[model samples]
Target: MQQWQRQKKASPKSQLKVTFLGEAGVDTGALRKEFLTEMLSEIERKLFVCNGDGKGKNPVYCLNSLDQKYFRIAGEIMSVSLAHGGPPPSFLREWCFQYLCSGDADHLQVCTSDVLDMEMSLLIAKVNDATEDSITDLTDEIINCGYTGVVSLEKKDRIVRAIVLHYTMRVLPMLDQLRKGLQLYDLLVLMEKYPDICLPLFVPVHSDDRVNSTFIMENCKTLFSEKGSVRRRQECG
Candidate 1:
């Protein structure tokens, strides 16, 4: 990723090539296509977590991910992949995607449900569903997170929402790094300028973006030797 970052801006605007260490096939765009697709999956697994709904994804708050700038690398990968006709991330939460494009969390409409951590989400649920019996336990959980507010049943909703915002706010640094990487190929500018057009790339609104055999056959050109030549027979063999 660092190597990719050091390249001239014009480099990523061109076709991408991929060569496997011990593989034999020539890269006729197929290898590059597959590489980008796999890289998106890798980024998802390494740096992001899926929401409770199992569709939208939020960035994970791992210090290592931030320190290593994995989000930035993911941004670079997405920019280069899209520039080279590869698939988009398409798994980010709509709010997360919007935050990337706008860099303003103040406008996000986040809720307790957006919290994906099992324990955290459970705490949120308990707080949201707090009753006379559950208020005490829920209050202790909120306090553990450094919230020193009066946790009454009437204020549970506010407390939970504040926790959610605090959780999301912790990843601001990670998002800043990602924004830096998205600067490649002027992608951030394009996304900000044409959000509707670029929305499908970051959100899973279009299932067609997933590359398939038909897409490969349509995008990849096959080469063949003369029909009567030994090379043609060798190709068949």
Candidate 2:
């Protein structure tokens, strides 16, 4: 175990900016297919991939290649650096951010959403996933990052409305938790919505149990500090 840890440095993959996009020889389950479909269509995906290995480090585990592929299907994957020294000879690299291979700036936009953010044109792609276009993923990247204003800006339209009904079903009930209130009271009220988005956190795999949802603060009322996390004092001398 120690040997593996020493060797397994968590930097970018040394090879071809290679993203393992869902391997398959045709045997993938329905749930995985559904997830894949959603993932492929999702516009906000960053590169924080969940491997099928199913260790305790992620919110969801890719049980099969299908799950992994489903995640990549939503957005196009690009290779940021072609050679070890730098990018390609062209002004644009083969791939830029948004996980896309195309470097064209004027292509028609597509509506993409994760299982979580389907309705809103808004997305919170991970910091690691931040390329030229930054996606504000709902993970720690949202609260801790120095961004307090709107992260996503798209006028609502057809593309943003595909899963409107489904998103409504999950969002309406869960929004009450975002209202200002005591944390414990909020937890008590929210605990009733178990297994839903309103629940603290729910993931298909057991590994997600450690990903604490309570830390997703909807506001930045406290002042900033250098030492990480703020002190909420009414007045200080």
**Highest lDDT model number:** 1
Task: List runs of model 2 lying over 4 Å from the truth.
Answer: 1-166, 178-182, 185-205, 208-237
> What is each predicted model's overall lDDT from 0 to 1?
0.77, 0.28
Model 1 segments more than 4 A misplaced: 1-15, 52-54, 144-146, 206-237
Worst 10 residues of 2 by lDDT: 87-96
| Candidate 2 lDDT over residue span 1-237, tens digit each | 122124336432343222235844433344434433333223122313323333211112223422334222211111112112221111111111211222222341322333233113233223224443444334233433233444443322222333333333332212222121112223323333331332222223344443233332332133545453344232332
State the lDDT at 168 in candidate 2: 30
Clashes of 2: 16
lDDT by residue (63-100, candidate 1, tens digit) is 98788777888888888877777777788888787888
**59 Cα displacement, candidate 2 (Å):** 19
Model 2 TM-score, 2 decimals:
0.16
